[model samples]
Target chain A: MKKVRTKQVIPLFMAGFAVVFGWVGVFKLGFWNPDQGPAPGFFPSIMAVVMFLTSILAFIQSFKEDGTVKYEKQELLVIASGAGIILSTFIIGLVGSCFLYIILWLKVFEKASWKDTLIILAVVAFIVIGVFGLWLGIQFPLGLMEYIL
Target chain B: MQNLQLLLHGFQTALTFQNVGAALIGAVLGLIVGAMPGIGSLAGVALLLPLTYKFNPTTAIIMLGALYYSNMYGGSFSAILLNIPGDSPAIMTALDGYPMASKKKRPGQALLTADLSSFIGGSIGICILTFTGPALANLGLKFGPSEMTALLLIAMTSISWLVGENPTKGVVITMFGIILASIGMDTLSGVPRYDFGNMYLLGGIPFTPYIIGAVGFSQVIKLIMERDQGKGGAATDMKLTIRGSMITKHDFRRLLPPALRSGFLGTFIGVLPGAGATTGSFMGYAVQKKMKSEEELGTGAIEGIASCEAANNAAAAGAFAPLLALGIPGSGTGAVLLGGLMMWGLNPGPLLFTNEPDFTWGLIASLFLSNILTLAIAVCVIPFLLKILSVPVKYMIPCITVVCVVGSYSSSYSMYGVLIMFLSGIAGYLLDKNDYPTAPMLLSFVLAPLLESNMRKAFIISGGSLDIFFTRPITCVLMVVFFGVVATPVVKSMMKNKTAGKASK
Candidate 1:
């Protein structure tokens, strides 16, 4: 079996995404109606078709290219951190999640001192809560704190 | 004379303490953001866009406009002192600016020349815009849906062609953007199209988060990916002093002519859709080089610095002309400004002059004042800017990410917006990694609804006939130009292939 290439992955993914999107637009969204001019799905269906065709062209173009998926350890860490952010956002509130994210990013990724991480986290939390919450009056969603508070 | 009176009234509004302060803060912020690598004026404006939510329309426009033009001045700093350009427009400046600073040992002089030339260019651009804006708006008032559709088509096609490496990719991305835009409740039909059974997406993926994620967060990711590559390091060793006689009499004499010429040239280029500061700077630099000897052209010639800097600044000012007068954005930044205008509930076309003369003229007047403020603030903040460059990228990354989250959330006061931003950032990163240009996607996304609505109106008026586009003189001309822009590259590539085939034979 031939190994998959990074160049091929994107186009293949794009093609798959386009097909699904097109299917949804056609079957679910209702692509056309005789009484009305163009329906809402008309534009999207056209886009889906165009995207599908382009993805195929892109795939064909990628076949001649010589490259492979090359993910380093650092890249994996970055991806993990990105996931950590989303998970934390759901687990904690916006401000709390941001606080946790800063601490972890600083301590783990940046390898900063505990003292510095704590200090920076305090400042970031103050600014985020102060400016956005107090000043702008934005009502951020509460997560775990919702029950406690 | 009446224009002059209106400008004075504009000055009265702009010179208020609050407005002046906003402009000052905007200029300072723009300068810092522009000097930072991986963040250009687009992201700078996008990052700060949420802050404008509380301000009045005039103040918001004033601050955003100040940020946009002052960014041009800031971009030249890194281009000169270091070989790295702070923004795309600054790329040409780096060609000669770095050479001048390093070889001539007059970094201050190089910076001063850039600043002065930028001022000259900006002043010229504002003067032209002030006079031509109303006149152009009058002409634009004559435009119907057919003409508007034609103009929008031209704007979309031009941006798609000029912005990216591959025009095909640009068009595809633009189409995707239009699809994304069509996801919300269709205003005419009163039907939600592609919300995917999700309540959060009902408003159609709030634009602020989408843009912030795409431009800002993706930039952070790109920076992280390149962190080990030793990019974004400080130029601490290079001393950028401002105390001495920066621009000597001799240097001024040599720089004046090219600066003035490029100022006009840049302004003209800026007025054209999709012809931005990058094009203006390169064209101005090329023209100056063609006029001079080889010795004077590339190797730290003051003329080289003057032409590029002046042209880019002028182009920055010139870009506002179309946006203000015709509601057609001339560049990516201008498109963002157009979005801001819509957000403020102010229509940006001809009626804007009559309906809100204060906002229109105040913005124009503020441009002139901002140039002067930029010069004063940029020179004073050189030391501070140099120090900022020394701050480690690691510390900045988390902070910027936090800002992106807060900024996106602040726009609509929703966590879903922040999530949208994160998702958009991932999508942006994936697309960007594949060599797709996001600016065209962004421009098209902003224009998509406007284009669709106008096209619909045009067809309805014409009783569902496409021939309406050809029947109108302005629309006919615009359609021809649109096709010409699209066809030129294809024809050129075909000719190149033919020549290559003959060579092979």
Candidate 2:
């Protein structure tokens, strides 16, 4: 119950940020001019205000919350590392950086055998490049070196 | 008779060598992808979108539609054998399906059960589609923008009922999705909303990346998170056969009624925007539970499998109704198809019927063939597909991740899309940790813009009169249905508690 209530805090804070973000965005960007039916910034600004209000409600509701919610910490590490892998892939090529991250994740964090990890990693990398890159023609950045070559 | 004539013409177009070839290719690929554990029909369709650019508009729509329908049929194979459903629609099947497999001396009996049920259900669904889709398309002929908006509202509100235990949380999540969708430039006006000084945000948050991120990437990431659990092997020593004796007359008697009834329910629910096979299958199973003999449920009953397969397959066909008629897509696959049609320079609406009857009819005709082909392929090749499931999860997760990354990037060749995929993965991880349902969030994200735009459009056209929703007959009917959907669950729960109290007293 406490965890469930606490979870409301995140969405509420995000919602508050949305409100501030919207207000600033609309003011900075301005609404549609004549010959335009609605401004691009118009909906975002409106959403920001709505999100902010809802977040406030969520936050208030969190304080008086009475339900049981379990907070599991194990998942947070995966979240951070997984996001890092994706962000890093854009900087490095699909094969190199993604391999480093997967190895680190599977062996170091999850504690699998090096043989098991390396074998799966190599096969997966090959398949990803072969199927998606070669067959489907998805331009997954092999990074600067490949691009320059 | 008139409808039959048009349908016959449709069959002529569909039966040609080129179109028949497309349906065959679509069925084979869709079944393969669907039978795979992690990848789903939605992903399969999305992955194939880039290829559709090469085909003519009608051929592309027909091919993609075939893939979508077959994936739904194919998902049940994994459910019966593995007990882990390939997709959400297959969840109910896994309940009794796996149990039946264990009980029978021949575990392959479970696999055969699923294949036969899929055949029965899919055929019935296609028959319904042939008879009813044109009539519904005709009804759509009368819908104006206001009515369209009302229909969209019904879709949006209906999410609360379909989502998890908390209706309020579902609504909040849906509202947030709407707000997220509203980011970037206003479609009606060129002004940027929450661009935050980035030119890239001008296109708004691309729905595809978010989908890949939230559902696809997150799922892969979680597999990484739980890599140690590893995968179990498919049951060996089970001789699976598709013989007549296995699916005897008694078995057909058990299966046919549920298959037909669920086909209708699935089609009806599927026609409603934002409702898809998941709800259709669940509702079908729930209804079957009530009508079933106490002796046969959750024991690998053929009826149980038929109910789910029929509704889900029908729902796949039914989802096209709103997309074809109102230019509104009810689910992710429908949304992707809508995008494909628009990319092909074909606008989907009532105007479509008048402007391009051949293309429209061709796509409908192709479905009839696709349904027949799915059964043919499954009966022939499902045993072979089962072999792929034995590959280790540790190995599979990395492959799934690669697919996720490539799938996300393929949506747009932008670096930002990859970033969105990553961020959505993390957010998906967090939501999973908190036990918050992702389906509501994903569904809301898909339908949010339609709901908002239609609402704004309706209000504007009515000169800000709220009565527009009540005053228009179609709108009024849709609104009533929306409220009814929201209230039905609550009423049922209350009645259940009252019954329990009476029994205790």
Candidate 3:
């Protein structure tokens, strides 16, 4: 079997999405209604068709391209940090996740001095707490700590 | 002229303590964010948007407007000093700006030319927008459902132009945006759409968070990937003061002509659908290449810096015309601003001029104020800005990430928005990695609902007949133009292929 190129991945993914969307649009959501001029499904159904055709075209076109950009090793840390931030929010909440992610990323990965890390941490804290919290008054999501408390 | 009086009144409103204060803050923040590499106007606006939720619609918009306007000035700083453009529009500025700064040994003068050129270009754009905005709104009022549908179709087609080379990828992304937009509910029938039965899908994806994730957070992922990639070393050794950055009379004379020409040209480009400052600056630089310059462009010429710098600022000002007049966004930042307008509880579109003259005009007046404010601040802070460029990418990565997290969460005060931000950030990185343009997706996402609404309304009016799009005069003209835009590429490609085929044979 021939190995698939990284470039073809997204187009193929979109093509598959279009197929499911087209099926749902036609069957579940009617394309046209008797009373309404165009049904809810009308635009989506048409768009799905266009999307599928274009995605397939893009997929085919990808074969002509030479080199593909590979993922960097450091990028895994960033992705992990993003996931960790989101996951941390479940336990520590929004503000805590900010503190945790910044600290770990700076200390563990960046290997920055504690003094530099704390200074950046303080500025970020001011923004999240002093500005976003006290000033703007946005109600942040409650973590498990809040629920437990 | 009535515009003069309205503008004067606008200044009166803008001169108020709060509005002036807002403009000042916006100018400062705009420059800071604009100077930062990787965080362009789109992300700047998106990251700052959540902070404005508590502001009055007028004040919030004034700040964001200043931020957007001044950002054009901020972009040239790094482009000239370092080789990296702070934003996409500044790519052209870098060509001559860095050369003039380094090779010519006039970093101060290069920075000055950019600031002055920005001032002149932005002023030209504002003046044109002043006369044209109300006039366009008046014209837009004459448009009914069919005409609006046609106009929106034109807007939708312009996004295809943004995707250079691969028409198929453009089409795929554009359709994908429209589909994503259709997920929440049908506006006409009040029926639920492709929500997949998720409770959060009932409200659809939140606009601000989606934008922040797509443009800003994605940069986080991108920066992480490229952390080791060298940033042409920061100019840390030099210290610059405003007085030190003065240009010679000869330099100013050389700068003025191209700046003036590009100002008008950029303004015209700005008003076009899906054409923003990037195109404006690119075009301005390209035009200067043909004309006589004091020195050849890309070789430390003042004219080269002036042309692109002036044009981008002019284009930034000009973009407000369509957004304020017809409620159409020409580019991603324009779309973000449109989203801001809606968030501030003001209706955008033709009626916006008639109904909310104060809000509309105040924003325009504030641009003039911001241009001056940004110029002064931009000059005084050149020394400080270099220091910012020196900030390690390692620190910036975590800082931007936190902002993305906080900004997304603040939009709706929910983890749902944050989830969308993360998911979209990953998707955005993937799309960007594959060389797919995200600007079209963002543009269509904002315009698709308006397009679908107007299109459906036209269908309803026409009793399901397609003739409505073709029958009305204004609509017919617009549809003709839309078809022309859509068909031109296809025709060109066919011609190219035919020529190739003949040669091959």
| Alpha-carbon shift of residue B196 in model 1 (angstroms) | 1.9
Ranking by TM-score: 3, 2, 1
Give model 2's DockQ, 2 decimals: 0.31
TM-score of each: 0.70, 0.71, 0.72
lDDT tens string, model 3, A8-68?
8899999999998888888888887766687778888899999999999999899898786
lDDT of each residue in B275-372, candidate 2, tens digit only: 57876776677678658543466566777777878888888887787787668887888898899899999999868765887787788888878888
Q: Please, what are the lDDT tens digits per residue for candidate 3 over residues B1-505?
A: 9988999999998989999999999998888667655457887788789889999888999999999899899888867865446676876787788778756657778888999999999999999999887564344356677876786676676666556468788889888888888888778888788788888997888765676677667767877655564332333344555565678899899999999999998987677666578767876876686689878776889998999999999999988888888888878888998998988888898788779989888989999899889988887876665454456667778877887788778766788888887887888788888888776676577668877887888888888899998888988998998898778769999999999999999
Output the lDDT of residue B122, model 3.
Answer: 98
Poorest stretch of ten by lDDT in candidate 2 chain B: B236-245
Candidate 3: C-alpha RMSD to true structure equals 7.1
Every candidate's TM-score, chain A alone: 0.80, 0.66, 0.93
CAPRI quality level assigned to candidate 3 from its DockQ score = medium
Q: What is the DockQ ranking, best to worst? A: 3, 1, 2
Angstrom error of the Cα, residue B196, model 3: value is 1.2
DockQ of each: 0.39, 0.31, 0.61
lDDT by residue (B18-121, candidate 1, tens digit) is 89998998898888767654356887787677899899999998999999999999888867764445676776677677667656656677788888999998
